[model samples]
Target: MKFTLFSLCRRYPIWVAVLLLYAVASLVSPAMLNPDQVLNIVRVTAFLGMVATGQTIVLLTGGIDLSVAGVVTLVNILSTGLMLGDNGNIFVAMLACVAVAAIVGVTNGVLVAYFRIAPIIATLAMNSILFGVALVYTGGAPHGAAAPAFNTIAQGDILGFPASGVCWLVLSIAVAMLMRKTVFGRWIYAVGANARAAAMMGVPVRLVVVAAYTLSSMLAMCGGLLVTAYIGNPSLGIGNSFMMTSVVAVVVGGTALSGGVGGVVTTIAGALFITELNSFTNIAQASTGAQFVIQGVLIAASVVVYRLLARRPRA
Candidate 1:
Protein backbone atom coordinates (compact mmCIF):
# COMPACT_ATOMS: atom_id res chain seq x y z
CA MET A 1 0.00 0.00 0.00
CA LYS A 2 2.79 2.36 0.91
CA PHE A 3 4.68 1.58 -2.26
CA THR A 4 1.52 1.92 -4.30
CA LEU A 5 0.76 5.30 -2.83
CA PHE A 6 4.40 6.32 -3.32
CA SER A 7 4.23 5.41 -6.97
CA LEU A 8 1.04 7.39 -7.36
CA CYS A 9 2.67 10.36 -5.69
CA ARG A 10 5.67 10.19 -8.00
CA ARG A 11 3.41 9.97 -11.01
CA TYR A 12 1.33 12.95 -9.90
CA PRO A 13 3.49 15.27 -7.89
CA ILE A 14 1.95 18.36 -9.42
CA TRP A 15 -1.58 17.38 -8.42
CA VAL A 16 -0.33 16.29 -5.05
CA ALA A 17 1.29 19.63 -4.57
CA VAL A 18 -1.85 21.45 -5.60
CA LEU A 19 -3.93 19.50 -3.11
CA LEU A 20 -1.33 20.21 -0.47
CA LEU A 21 -1.52 23.88 -1.23
CA TYR A 22 -5.28 23.73 -0.94
CA ALA A 23 -4.96 22.14 2.42
CA VAL A 24 -2.52 24.76 3.58
CA ALA A 25 -4.63 27.59 2.25
CA SER A 26 -7.64 26.22 4.03
CA LEU A 27 -5.75 25.90 7.26
CA VAL A 28 -4.25 29.36 6.98
CA SER A 29 -7.54 31.00 6.20
CA PRO A 30 -10.61 29.15 7.22
CA ALA A 31 -12.61 31.09 4.71
CA MET A 32 -10.69 29.37 1.98
CA LEU A 33 -11.97 26.12 3.40
CA ASN A 34 -15.56 27.17 3.17
CA PRO A 35 -17.58 25.12 0.77
CA ASP A 36 -18.60 28.09 -1.30
CA GLN A 37 -15.06 29.44 -1.69
CA VAL A 38 -13.57 26.05 -2.45
CA LEU A 39 -16.35 25.27 -4.87
CA ASN A 40 -15.86 28.61 -6.60
CA ILE A 41 -12.17 27.96 -7.13
CA VAL A 42 -12.80 24.49 -8.48
CA ARG A 43 -15.57 25.81 -10.67
CA VAL A 44 -13.38 28.52 -12.11
CA THR A 45 -10.58 26.09 -12.76
CA ALA A 46 -12.81 23.82 -14.85
CA PHE A 47 -12.82 25.89 -18.02
CA LEU A 48 -9.07 26.38 -18.00
CA GLY A 49 -8.44 22.84 -16.88
CA MET A 50 -10.73 21.32 -19.52
CA VAL A 51 -9.10 23.33 -22.31
CA ALA A 52 -5.62 22.59 -21.03
CA THR A 53 -6.40 18.88 -20.97
CA GLY A 54 -7.03 18.90 -24.69
CA GLN A 55 -3.84 20.82 -25.24
CA THR A 56 -2.04 18.21 -23.18
CA ILE A 57 -3.40 15.42 -25.35
CA VAL A 58 -2.43 17.17 -28.56
CA LEU A 59 1.02 17.95 -27.25
CA LEU A 60 1.34 14.34 -26.14
CA THR A 61 0.77 13.37 -29.74
CA GLY A 62 3.55 15.73 -30.84
CA GLY A 63 1.38 18.65 -31.92
CA ILE A 64 -0.02 21.90 -30.62
CA ASP A 65 -3.41 23.53 -31.24
CA LEU A 66 -3.12 27.31 -31.18
CA SER A 67 -6.67 27.74 -32.46
CA VAL A 68 -8.23 26.58 -29.19
CA ALA A 69 -8.95 30.07 -27.93
CA GLY A 70 -10.56 31.16 -31.13
CA VAL A 71 -12.57 27.98 -31.37
CA VAL A 72 -13.77 28.48 -27.83
CA THR A 73 -14.68 32.11 -28.42
CA LEU A 74 -16.57 31.28 -31.53
CA VAL A 75 -18.46 28.49 -29.82
CA ASN A 76 -19.37 30.72 -26.90
CA ILE A 77 -20.95 33.14 -29.30
CA LEU A 78 -22.75 30.38 -31.14
CA SER A 79 -24.23 29.11 -27.89
CA THR A 80 -25.34 32.52 -26.77
CA GLY A 81 -26.29 34.14 -30.06
CA LEU A 82 -28.32 31.27 -31.38
CA MET A 83 -29.82 29.75 -28.26
CA LEU A 84 -30.42 32.62 -25.90
CA GLY A 85 -34.07 33.15 -26.76
CA ASP A 86 -35.25 29.68 -27.65
CA ASN A 87 -34.68 26.41 -25.85
CA GLY A 88 -35.30 24.52 -29.09
CA ASN A 89 -32.40 26.29 -30.77
CA ILE A 90 -29.81 25.21 -28.21
CA PHE A 91 -29.20 21.70 -29.45
CA VAL A 92 -28.83 22.65 -33.07
CA ALA A 93 -26.65 25.56 -32.16
CA MET A 94 -24.36 23.30 -30.15
CA LEU A 95 -24.08 20.85 -33.01
CA ALA A 96 -23.21 23.64 -35.37
CA CYS A 97 -20.52 24.96 -33.08
CA VAL A 98 -19.04 21.49 -32.65
CA ALA A 99 -19.18 20.92 -36.36
CA VAL A 100 -17.27 24.12 -36.92
CA ALA A 101 -14.69 23.12 -34.37
CA ALA A 102 -14.26 19.72 -36.04
CA ILE A 103 -13.85 21.31 -39.43
CA VAL A 104 -11.15 23.57 -38.07
CA GLY A 105 -9.48 20.59 -36.40
CA VAL A 106 -9.56 18.63 -39.63
CA THR A 107 -8.05 21.54 -41.48
CA ASN A 108 -5.23 21.78 -39.00
CA GLY A 109 -4.62 18.05 -39.17
CA VAL A 110 -4.62 18.04 -42.96
CA LEU A 111 -2.05 20.78 -43.09
CA VAL A 112 0.24 19.21 -40.55
CA ALA A 113 -0.29 15.56 -41.42
CA TYR A 114 -0.29 15.54 -45.21
CA PHE A 115 0.98 18.91 -46.36
CA ARG A 116 3.98 18.72 -44.05
CA ILE A 117 3.28 22.17 -42.70
CA ALA A 118 4.70 22.93 -39.30
CA PRO A 119 2.07 22.36 -36.63
CA ILE A 120 2.80 25.70 -35.02
CA ILE A 121 2.46 27.68 -38.24
CA ALA A 122 -0.54 25.72 -39.41
CA THR A 123 -2.41 26.14 -36.15
CA LEU A 124 -1.42 29.78 -35.94
CA ALA A 125 -2.92 30.46 -39.35
CA MET A 126 -6.02 28.54 -38.39
CA ASN A 127 -6.22 30.68 -35.29
CA SER A 128 -6.24 33.78 -37.47
CA ILE A 129 -9.02 32.40 -39.61
CA LEU A 130 -11.09 31.38 -36.64
CA PHE A 131 -10.64 34.82 -35.08
CA GLY A 132 -11.72 36.51 -38.29
CA VAL A 133 -14.71 34.26 -38.66
CA ALA A 134 -15.74 35.03 -35.11
CA LEU A 135 -15.31 38.76 -35.69
CA VAL A 136 -17.45 38.58 -38.82
CA TYR A 137 -20.13 36.55 -37.09
CA THR A 138 -20.40 39.05 -34.29
CA GLY A 139 -19.60 42.21 -36.29
CA GLY A 140 -17.20 43.64 -33.67
CA ALA A 141 -19.68 43.34 -30.85
CA PRO A 142 -20.86 40.15 -29.16
CA HIS A 143 -24.34 39.84 -27.72
CA GLY A 144 -26.08 36.90 -26.10
CA ALA A 145 -26.51 35.53 -22.66
CA ALA A 146 -25.63 31.95 -21.81
CA ALA A 147 -28.64 29.80 -21.01
CA PRO A 148 -29.35 29.09 -17.37
CA ALA A 149 -28.85 25.34 -17.73
CA PHE A 150 -25.52 25.97 -19.33
CA ASN A 151 -24.59 28.25 -16.48
CA THR A 152 -25.58 25.63 -13.95
CA ILE A 153 -22.72 23.35 -14.90
CA ALA A 154 -20.28 25.99 -13.80
CA GLN A 155 -22.30 27.33 -10.90
CA GLY A 156 -24.45 24.60 -9.48
CA ASP A 157 -22.91 22.19 -7.03
CA ILE A 158 -24.06 18.76 -5.95
CA LEU A 159 -23.94 18.47 -2.19
CA GLY A 160 -21.29 21.19 -2.13
CA PHE A 161 -19.12 20.85 -5.30
CA PRO A 162 -19.71 22.50 -8.61
CA ALA A 163 -20.96 20.20 -11.34
CA SER A 164 -18.33 21.49 -13.73
CA GLY A 165 -15.66 20.61 -11.22
CA VAL A 166 -17.05 17.10 -11.06
CA CYS A 167 -17.16 17.03 -14.80
CA TRP A 168 -13.53 18.05 -15.06
CA LEU A 169 -12.42 15.56 -12.44
CA VAL A 170 -14.26 12.70 -14.09
CA LEU A 171 -13.12 13.66 -17.53
CA SER A 172 -9.52 13.91 -16.42
CA ILE A 173 -9.65 10.50 -14.85
CA ALA A 174 -11.19 9.02 -17.99
CA VAL A 175 -8.59 10.64 -20.24
CA ALA A 176 -5.76 9.58 -17.99
CA MET A 177 -7.07 6.06 -17.88
CA LEU A 178 -7.48 6.08 -21.63
CA MET A 179 -3.90 7.20 -22.07
CA ARG A 180 -2.36 4.93 -19.51
CA LYS A 181 -4.43 1.80 -19.86
CA THR A 182 -5.46 1.57 -23.47
CA VAL A 183 -3.99 0.76 -26.87
CA PHE A 184 -4.81 4.14 -28.39
CA GLY A 185 -3.04 5.74 -25.51
CA ARG A 186 0.08 3.76 -26.33
CA TRP A 187 -0.24 4.76 -29.98
CA ILE A 188 -0.45 8.41 -28.93
CA TYR A 189 2.78 8.23 -26.96
CA ALA A 190 4.42 6.31 -29.77
CA VAL A 191 3.42 8.90 -32.34
CA GLY A 192 4.58 11.70 -30.10
CA ALA A 193 7.86 9.99 -29.52
CA ASN A 194 8.54 9.43 -33.21
CA ALA A 195 5.99 9.61 -35.99
CA ARG A 196 8.29 8.07 -38.57
CA ALA A 197 9.27 5.30 -36.22
CA ALA A 198 5.66 4.73 -35.28
CA ALA A 199 4.77 4.36 -38.94
CA MET A 200 7.56 1.89 -39.34
CA MET A 201 6.12 -0.04 -36.43
CA GLY A 202 2.69 -0.20 -38.11
CA VAL A 203 1.03 2.59 -36.14
CA PRO A 204 -1.45 4.65 -38.13
CA VAL A 205 0.33 7.93 -37.46
CA ARG A 206 -1.76 10.11 -39.77
CA LEU A 207 -5.06 8.85 -38.47
CA VAL A 208 -3.81 9.27 -34.94
CA VAL A 209 -2.83 12.83 -35.63
CA VAL A 210 -6.21 13.66 -37.14
CA ALA A 211 -8.06 11.98 -34.33
CA ALA A 212 -6.07 13.85 -31.72
CA TYR A 213 -7.05 17.12 -33.30
CA THR A 214 -10.70 16.08 -33.35
CA LEU A 215 -10.58 15.25 -29.66
CA SER A 216 -8.96 18.60 -29.03
CA SER A 217 -11.79 20.35 -30.80
CA MET A 218 -14.37 18.54 -28.71
CA LEU A 219 -12.63 19.52 -25.49
CA ALA A 220 -12.36 23.13 -26.60
CA MET A 221 -16.07 23.24 -27.33
CA CYS A 222 -16.86 21.88 -23.90
CA GLY A 223 -14.70 24.54 -22.33
CA GLY A 224 -16.38 27.26 -24.33
CA LEU A 225 -19.74 26.31 -22.91
CA LEU A 226 -18.32 26.47 -19.41
CA VAL A 227 -16.57 29.77 -20.04
CA THR A 228 -19.67 31.42 -21.47
CA ALA A 229 -21.57 30.43 -18.36
CA TYR A 230 -18.76 31.33 -16.00
CA ILE A 231 -18.68 34.86 -17.31
CA GLY A 232 -22.49 35.08 -17.63
CA ASN A 233 -22.47 36.36 -21.19
CA PRO A 234 -20.65 36.22 -24.45
CA SER A 235 -18.15 39.01 -24.95
CA LEU A 236 -15.69 39.85 -27.66
CA GLY A 237 -12.30 38.28 -27.16
CA ILE A 238 -13.28 36.72 -23.85
CA GLY A 239 -11.30 33.62 -24.70
CA ASN A 240 -8.38 35.51 -26.19
CA SER A 241 -5.97 34.63 -23.40
CA PHE A 242 -6.85 30.95 -23.18
CA MET A 243 -4.44 29.77 -25.85
CA MET A 244 -1.41 30.99 -23.98
CA THR A 245 -2.76 29.98 -20.61
CA SER A 246 -3.46 26.44 -21.82
CA VAL A 247 0.07 26.06 -23.16
CA VAL A 248 1.54 27.50 -19.99
CA ALA A 249 -0.47 25.15 -17.81
CA VAL A 250 0.55 22.14 -19.88
CA VAL A 251 4.22 23.06 -19.68
CA VAL A 252 4.16 24.07 -16.04
CA GLY A 253 2.42 20.79 -15.22
CA GLY A 254 5.58 19.04 -16.42
CA THR A 255 4.40 17.99 -19.86
CA ALA A 256 7.19 18.09 -22.41
CA LEU A 257 6.61 20.48 -25.26
CA SER A 258 8.31 18.00 -27.55
CA GLY A 259 5.65 15.49 -26.40
CA GLY A 260 4.80 12.22 -24.61
CA VAL A 261 5.98 12.88 -21.09
CA GLY A 262 3.14 14.11 -18.92
CA GLY A 263 -0.51 13.48 -18.03
CA VAL A 264 -3.75 15.42 -17.57
CA VAL A 265 -3.45 15.16 -13.78
CA THR A 266 -0.38 17.33 -13.88
CA THR A 267 -2.11 19.89 -16.07
CA ILE A 268 -4.81 20.19 -13.39
CA ALA A 269 -2.11 21.07 -10.88
CA GLY A 270 -0.61 23.64 -13.19
CA ALA A 271 -4.05 25.22 -13.56
CA LEU A 272 -4.51 25.38 -9.80
CA PHE A 273 -1.06 26.83 -9.30
CA ILE A 274 -1.81 29.56 -11.78
CA THR A 275 -5.29 30.21 -10.40
CA GLU A 276 -3.90 30.33 -6.87
CA LEU A 277 -1.24 32.77 -7.95
CA ASN A 278 -3.90 34.95 -9.50
CA SER A 279 -6.06 34.78 -6.39
CA PHE A 280 -3.11 35.63 -4.20
CA THR A 281 -2.19 38.51 -6.44
CA ASN A 282 -5.71 39.86 -6.37
CA ILE A 283 -5.69 39.54 -2.63
CA ALA A 284 -2.50 41.53 -2.54
CA GLN A 285 -4.03 44.22 -4.77
CA ALA A 286 -1.68 43.66 -7.68
CA SER A 287 -2.40 45.16 -11.06
CA THR A 288 -3.24 42.98 -14.04
CA GLY A 289 -0.06 44.16 -15.78
CA ALA A 290 1.98 43.22 -12.76
CA GLN A 291 0.37 39.79 -12.74
CA PHE A 292 1.26 39.26 -16.38
CA VAL A 293 4.82 40.42 -15.83
CA ILE A 294 5.26 37.96 -13.01
CA GLN A 295 3.57 35.16 -14.94
CA GLY A 296 5.65 35.80 -18.05
CA VAL A 297 8.87 35.78 -16.05
CA LEU A 298 7.82 32.56 -14.37
CA ILE A 299 7.01 30.85 -17.68
CA ALA A 300 10.34 31.92 -19.19
CA ALA A 301 12.31 30.87 -16.15
CA SER A 302 10.47 27.55 -16.07
CA VAL A 303 11.26 26.81 -19.71
CA VAL A 304 14.91 27.50 -19.09
CA VAL A 305 14.92 25.29 -16.06
CA TYR A 306 13.15 22.50 -17.96
CA ARG A 307 15.67 22.73 -20.77
CA LEU A 308 18.60 22.62 -18.38
CA LEU A 309 17.20 19.75 -16.36
CA ALA A 310 16.05 17.79 -19.41
CA ARG A 311 19.51 17.96 -20.94
CA ARG A 312 21.97 15.12 -20.92
CA PRO A 313 25.75 15.70 -20.80
CA ARG A 314 27.61 14.77 -23.96
CA ALA A 315 28.78 11.20 -23.86
Candidate 2:
Protein backbone atom coordinates (compact mmCIF):
# COMPACT_ATOMS: atom_id res chain seq x y z
CA MET A 1 0.00 0.00 0.00
CA LYS A 2 1.13 3.55 -0.76
CA PHE A 3 1.41 6.20 1.94
CA THR A 4 0.47 9.89 1.74
CA LEU A 5 0.47 12.91 3.98
CA PHE A 6 -3.32 12.97 4.07
CA SER A 7 -3.39 9.31 5.04
CA LEU A 8 -0.86 9.94 7.76
CA CYS A 9 -2.84 12.84 9.10
CA ARG A 10 -6.04 10.86 8.85
CA ARG A 11 -4.46 8.08 10.85
CA TYR A 12 -2.91 10.27 13.53
CA PRO A 13 -4.37 13.73 13.69
CA ILE A 14 -4.89 13.55 17.43
CA TRP A 15 -1.24 12.73 18.02
CA VAL A 16 -0.25 15.75 15.99
CA ALA A 17 -2.71 17.85 17.92
CA VAL A 18 -1.27 16.65 21.21
CA LEU A 19 2.27 17.64 20.24
CA LEU A 20 1.17 21.00 18.88
CA LEU A 21 -0.95 21.73 21.90
CA TYR A 22 1.89 20.84 24.24
CA ALA A 23 4.29 23.09 22.38
CA VAL A 24 1.88 25.99 22.55
CA ALA A 25 0.97 25.30 26.16
CA SER A 26 4.63 25.23 27.21
CA LEU A 27 5.22 28.51 25.45
CA VAL A 28 2.14 30.10 26.99
CA SER A 29 2.66 28.74 30.50
CA PRO A 30 6.13 27.62 31.42
CA ALA A 31 4.65 25.71 34.32
CA MET A 32 3.08 23.36 31.78
CA LEU A 33 6.58 22.12 31.05
CA ASN A 34 7.22 21.19 34.64
CA PRO A 35 7.62 17.48 35.30
CA ASP A 36 5.09 17.54 38.12
CA GLN A 37 2.60 19.41 36.03
CA VAL A 38 3.01 16.96 33.16
CA LEU A 39 2.45 14.10 35.55
CA ASN A 40 -0.60 15.85 36.93
CA ILE A 41 -2.02 16.06 33.43
CA VAL A 42 -1.37 12.37 32.91
CA ARG A 43 -2.96 11.58 36.27
CA VAL A 44 -6.09 13.52 35.48
CA THR A 45 -6.32 12.16 31.95
CA ALA A 46 -6.56 8.63 33.28
CA PHE A 47 -10.16 9.06 34.39
CA LEU A 48 -11.37 10.28 31.02
CA GLY A 49 -9.05 7.90 29.20
CA MET A 50 -10.63 4.96 30.92
CA VAL A 51 -14.11 6.02 29.93
CA ALA A 52 -13.14 7.06 26.42
CA THR A 53 -11.51 3.73 25.78
CA GLY A 54 -14.91 2.12 26.00
CA GLN A 55 -16.38 4.87 23.91
CA THR A 56 -13.80 4.05 21.27
CA ILE A 57 -14.94 0.46 21.20
CA VAL A 58 -18.59 1.37 20.96
CA LEU A 59 -17.93 3.78 18.15
CA LEU A 60 -15.97 1.10 16.34
CA THR A 61 -19.12 -1.00 16.49
CA GLY A 62 -21.15 1.89 15.10
CA GLY A 63 -22.81 2.82 18.38
CA ILE A 64 -22.75 5.47 21.08
CA ASP A 65 -23.09 5.25 24.83
CA LEU A 66 -24.39 8.49 26.25
CA SER A 67 -25.25 6.45 29.29
CA VAL A 68 -21.60 6.42 30.26
CA ALA A 69 -22.03 9.60 32.23
CA GLY A 70 -24.88 8.09 34.12
CA VAL A 71 -22.91 4.89 34.61
CA VAL A 72 -20.05 6.90 36.05
CA THR A 73 -22.24 8.82 38.45
CA LEU A 74 -24.20 5.77 39.49
CA VAL A 75 -21.05 3.77 40.04
CA ASN A 76 -19.48 6.62 41.96
CA ILE A 77 -22.44 7.02 44.23
CA LEU A 78 -22.99 3.31 44.66
CA SER A 79 -19.37 2.32 45.26
CA THR A 80 -18.67 5.02 47.79
CA GLY A 81 -21.95 4.48 49.53
CA LEU A 82 -21.31 0.78 49.72
CA MET A 83 -17.70 1.19 50.76
CA LEU A 84 -18.54 3.67 53.45
CA GLY A 85 -14.86 4.36 54.13
CA ASP A 86 -14.16 0.80 55.23
CA ASN A 87 -11.55 -1.35 53.56
CA GLY A 88 -13.56 -4.50 54.08
CA ASN A 89 -16.46 -3.01 52.20
CA ILE A 90 -14.39 -2.27 49.12
CA PHE A 91 -14.75 -5.73 47.61
CA VAL A 92 -18.49 -5.86 48.07
CA ALA A 93 -18.88 -2.36 46.82
CA MET A 94 -16.87 -3.10 43.70
CA LEU A 95 -18.73 -6.31 43.03
CA ALA A 96 -22.01 -4.54 43.38
CA CYS A 97 -20.91 -1.75 41.13
CA VAL A 98 -19.73 -4.19 38.47
CA ALA A 99 -23.04 -6.04 38.58
CA VAL A 100 -25.02 -2.86 38.22
CA ALA A 101 -22.87 -1.66 35.38
CA ALA A 102 -23.20 -4.99 33.59
CA ILE A 103 -26.95 -4.90 33.88
CA VAL A 104 -27.06 -1.42 32.45
CA GLY A 105 -24.75 -2.38 29.62
CA VAL A 106 -26.80 -5.44 28.74
CA THR A 107 -29.94 -3.41 28.67
CA ASN A 108 -28.36 -0.89 26.34
CA GLY A 109 -27.11 -3.66 24.09
CA VAL A 110 -30.48 -5.36 23.91
CA LEU A 111 -32.24 -2.16 23.14
CA VAL A 112 -29.87 -1.25 20.35
CA ALA A 113 -28.92 -4.61 18.92
CA TYR A 114 -32.08 -6.67 19.37
CA PHE A 115 -34.90 -4.23 19.79
CA ARG A 116 -33.47 -2.07 16.99
CA ILE A 117 -33.60 1.14 18.96
CA ALA A 118 -31.33 3.89 17.75
CA PRO A 119 -28.14 3.96 19.80
CA ILE A 120 -28.42 7.60 20.77
CA ILE A 121 -32.02 7.38 21.89
CA ALA A 122 -31.48 4.05 23.66
CA THR A 123 -28.40 5.17 25.53
CA LEU A 124 -29.85 8.57 26.25
CA ALA A 125 -32.96 7.00 27.75
CA MET A 126 -30.79 4.59 29.65
CA ASN A 127 -28.82 7.52 30.97
CA SER A 128 -31.97 9.08 32.30
CA ILE A 129 -33.00 5.83 33.93
CA LEU A 130 -29.61 5.31 35.50
CA PHE A 131 -29.49 8.86 36.81
CA GLY A 132 -32.98 8.48 38.18
CA VAL A 133 -32.02 5.32 40.01
CA ALA A 134 -28.99 7.06 41.44
CA LEU A 135 -31.10 9.97 42.59
CA VAL A 136 -33.66 7.73 44.19
CA TYR A 137 -30.97 5.70 45.87
CA THR A 138 -29.21 8.72 47.25
CA GLY A 139 -32.29 10.83 47.82
CA GLY A 140 -30.39 13.72 46.24
CA ALA A 141 -27.78 13.50 49.02
CA PRO A 142 -25.23 10.71 48.60
CA HIS A 143 -23.44 9.41 51.66
CA GLY A 144 -20.11 7.68 52.45
CA ALA A 145 -16.48 8.19 51.59
CA ALA A 146 -13.82 6.23 49.75
CA ALA A 147 -11.75 3.87 51.82
CA PRO A 148 -8.14 4.95 52.32
CA ALA A 149 -6.88 1.78 50.71
CA PHE A 150 -9.14 2.22 47.73
CA ASN A 151 -8.03 5.77 47.29
CA THR A 152 -4.51 4.54 46.61
CA ILE A 153 -5.57 3.45 43.14
CA ALA A 154 -6.10 7.05 42.09
CA GLN A 155 -3.93 9.02 44.55
CA GLY A 156 -0.89 6.77 44.90
CA ASP A 157 2.00 6.45 42.51
CA ILE A 158 3.87 3.56 40.94
CA LEU A 159 7.51 4.02 40.02
CA GLY A 160 7.08 7.80 40.16
CA PHE A 161 3.98 7.64 37.90
CA PRO A 162 0.39 8.01 38.97
CA ALA A 163 -1.16 4.63 39.74
CA SER A 164 -4.27 5.51 37.81
CA GLY A 165 -2.15 6.49 34.83
CA VAL A 166 -0.29 3.25 35.07
CA CYS A 167 -3.55 1.39 35.20
CA TRP A 168 -4.84 3.30 32.20
CA LEU A 169 -1.68 2.55 30.27
CA VAL A 170 -1.85 -1.16 30.98
CA LEU A 171 -5.51 -1.37 30.13
CA SER A 172 -5.08 0.67 26.96
CA ILE A 173 -2.33 -1.60 25.75
CA ALA A 174 -4.42 -4.65 26.50
CA VAL A 175 -7.49 -3.23 24.80
CA ALA A 176 -5.55 -2.06 21.77
CA MET A 177 -4.16 -5.52 21.35
CA LEU A 178 -7.58 -7.04 21.69
CA MET A 179 -9.01 -4.76 19.05
CA ARG A 180 -6.18 -5.40 16.63
CA LYS A 181 -5.36 -9.05 17.15
CA THR A 182 -8.52 -10.86 18.21
CA VAL A 183 -11.41 -12.42 16.34
CA PHE A 184 -13.91 -10.65 18.55
CA GLY A 185 -12.21 -7.39 17.72
CA ARG A 186 -12.56 -8.11 14.03
CA TRP A 187 -16.20 -8.84 14.57
CA ILE A 188 -16.70 -5.46 16.19
CA TYR A 189 -15.20 -3.65 13.22
CA ALA A 190 -17.04 -5.80 10.74
CA VAL A 191 -20.32 -5.13 12.44
CA GLY A 192 -19.65 -1.46 12.56
CA ALA A 193 -18.58 -1.24 8.96
CA ASN A 194 -21.82 -2.91 7.83
CA ALA A 195 -24.02 -4.81 10.19
CA ARG A 196 -26.07 -6.39 7.40
CA ALA A 197 -22.96 -7.65 5.64
CA ALA A 198 -21.40 -8.74 8.89
CA ALA A 199 -24.48 -10.65 9.82
CA MET A 200 -24.55 -12.32 6.43
CA MET A 201 -20.95 -13.32 6.99
CA GLY A 202 -21.94 -14.97 10.27
CA VAL A 203 -20.21 -12.40 12.47
CA PRO A 204 -22.80 -12.61 15.20
CA VAL A 205 -23.61 -8.94 14.87
CA ARG A 206 -25.99 -8.72 17.78
CA LEU A 207 -23.58 -10.47 20.10
CA VAL A 208 -20.76 -8.18 19.09
CA VAL A 209 -22.94 -5.13 19.59
CA VAL A 210 -24.03 -6.35 23.01
CA ALA A 211 -20.47 -7.13 24.02
CA ALA A 212 -19.30 -3.72 22.90
CA TYR A 213 -21.92 -1.98 25.00
CA THR A 214 -21.21 -4.21 27.99
CA LEU A 215 -17.53 -3.42 27.80
CA SER A 216 -18.32 0.25 27.46
CA SER A 217 -20.37 0.25 30.63
CA MET A 218 -17.84 -1.79 32.54
CA LEU A 219 -15.07 0.61 31.64
CA ALA A 220 -17.26 3.55 32.52
CA MET A 221 -17.72 1.95 35.91
CA CYS A 222 -13.98 1.60 36.24
CA GLY A 223 -13.63 5.29 35.46
CA GLY A 224 -16.26 6.08 38.02
CA LEU A 225 -14.36 4.07 40.61
CA LEU A 226 -11.15 5.94 39.88
CA VAL A 227 -12.88 9.31 40.08
CA THR A 228 -14.56 8.32 43.31
CA ALA A 229 -11.16 7.29 44.66
CA TYR A 230 -9.70 10.68 43.79
CA ILE A 231 -12.55 12.67 45.24
CA GLY A 232 -13.13 10.33 48.20
CA ASN A 233 -16.74 11.41 48.43
CA PRO A 234 -19.92 11.08 46.47
CA SER A 235 -21.49 14.05 44.73
CA LEU A 236 -24.37 14.48 42.36
CA GLY A 237 -23.43 15.08 38.72
CA ILE A 238 -19.90 13.94 39.41
CA GLY A 239 -19.83 12.48 35.94
CA ASN A 240 -21.62 15.25 34.10
CA SER A 241 -18.45 16.44 32.40
CA PHE A 242 -17.58 13.00 31.09
CA MET A 243 -20.77 12.63 29.03
CA MET A 244 -19.63 14.99 26.32
CA THR A 245 -15.91 14.87 27.01
CA SER A 246 -15.71 11.15 26.48
CA VAL A 247 -17.35 11.51 23.06
CA VAL A 248 -15.10 14.46 22.33
CA ALA A 249 -11.99 12.45 23.10
CA VAL A 250 -13.08 9.59 20.92
CA VAL A 251 -14.10 11.82 18.01
CA VAL A 252 -10.99 13.96 18.24
CA GLY A 253 -8.93 10.81 18.24
CA GLY A 254 -10.12 10.29 14.64
CA THR A 255 -12.67 7.63 15.37
CA ALA A 256 -15.40 7.74 12.78
CA LEU A 257 -18.68 8.86 14.22
CA SER A 258 -20.12 6.58 11.56
CA GLY A 259 -18.02 3.68 12.93
CA GLY A 260 -15.53 0.99 11.76
CA VAL A 261 -12.53 3.30 12.01
CA GLY A 262 -10.05 4.34 14.68
CA GLY A 263 -8.86 2.49 17.77
CA VAL A 264 -7.90 2.95 21.40
CA VAL A 265 -4.28 3.94 20.72
CA THR A 266 -5.13 7.27 19.11
CA THR A 267 -7.66 7.92 21.85
CA ILE A 268 -4.81 7.96 24.38
CA ALA A 269 -3.40 10.96 22.58
CA GLY A 270 -6.89 12.43 22.30
CA ALA A 271 -7.36 12.15 26.04
CA LEU A 272 -3.99 13.76 26.71
CA PHE A 273 -4.76 16.58 24.30
CA ILE A 274 -8.08 17.26 25.99
CA THR A 275 -6.55 17.32 29.45
CA GLU A 276 -3.78 19.59 28.24
CA LEU A 277 -6.34 21.91 26.66
CA ASN A 278 -8.33 22.05 29.88
CA SER A 279 -5.20 22.66 31.93
CA PHE A 280 -4.08 25.40 29.60
CA THR A 281 -7.46 27.06 29.77
CA ASN A 282 -7.36 26.95 33.56
CA ILE A 283 -3.86 28.38 33.65
CA ALA A 284 -4.94 31.14 31.31
CA GLN A 285 -7.96 31.85 33.53
CA ALA A 286 -10.44 31.24 30.73
CA SER A 287 -14.07 31.11 31.73
CA THR A 288 -16.04 27.86 31.79
CA GLY A 289 -18.17 29.05 28.89
CA ALA A 290 -15.01 29.76 26.93
CA GLN A 291 -13.77 26.24 27.53
CA PHE A 292 -17.02 24.76 26.26
CA VAL A 293 -16.92 26.94 23.20
CA ILE A 294 -13.34 25.94 22.54
CA GLN A 295 -14.18 22.27 22.87
CA GLY A 296 -17.15 22.60 20.55
CA VAL A 297 -14.96 24.27 17.98
CA LEU A 298 -12.31 21.62 18.36
CA ILE A 299 -14.82 18.87 17.72
CA ALA A 300 -16.20 20.55 14.65
CA ALA A 301 -12.75 21.26 13.31
CA SER A 302 -11.61 17.70 13.87
CA VAL A 303 -14.64 16.25 12.11
CA VAL A 304 -14.13 18.48 9.10
CA VAL A 305 -10.39 17.92 8.96
CA TYR A 306 -10.70 14.18 9.25
CA ARG A 307 -13.38 14.01 6.59
CA LEU A 308 -11.27 16.02 4.23
CA LEU A 309 -8.23 13.90 4.82
CA ALA A 310 -10.21 10.74 4.40
CA ARG A 311 -11.49 11.94 1.04
CA ARG A 312 -8.07 12.81 -0.35
CA PRO A 313 -6.68 10.39 -2.91
CA ARG A 314 -3.55 8.44 -2.07
CA ALA A 315 -0.27 9.62 -3.59
The number of the candidate with the highest lDDT is 2
lDDT of each: 0.81, 0.92
What is candidate 1's lDDT per residue for 80-193, written digit by digit as tens? 898774567777778888899889888888888889888899988988888898899889887777777667778787777788888888887788888899989899899999
Q: List the residue pairs that clash in candidate 1.
A: none
Q: Model 2 over residues 1-315: C-alpha lDDT tens digits?
A: 547755556557788789889999889899999999999999999999999999999999999999999999999999999999999999999999999999999999999999999999999999999899999999998999999999999999999999999988899889999999999999999998999999999999998999999999998998999999999999888989898899999999989989998899999988898999999999988999999999899999998988888788655
Clashing pairs in 2: none
Q: Residue 39: error of model 2 in Å? A: 0.5
- Global CA lDDT computed for model 2: 0.92
- lDDT score, residue 281, model 1? 61
Clashes of each: 0, 0
Candidate with the greatest TM-score versus the true structure: 2
Question: Least accurate stretch of 10 residues (summed lDDT) in model 2?
Answer: 1-10
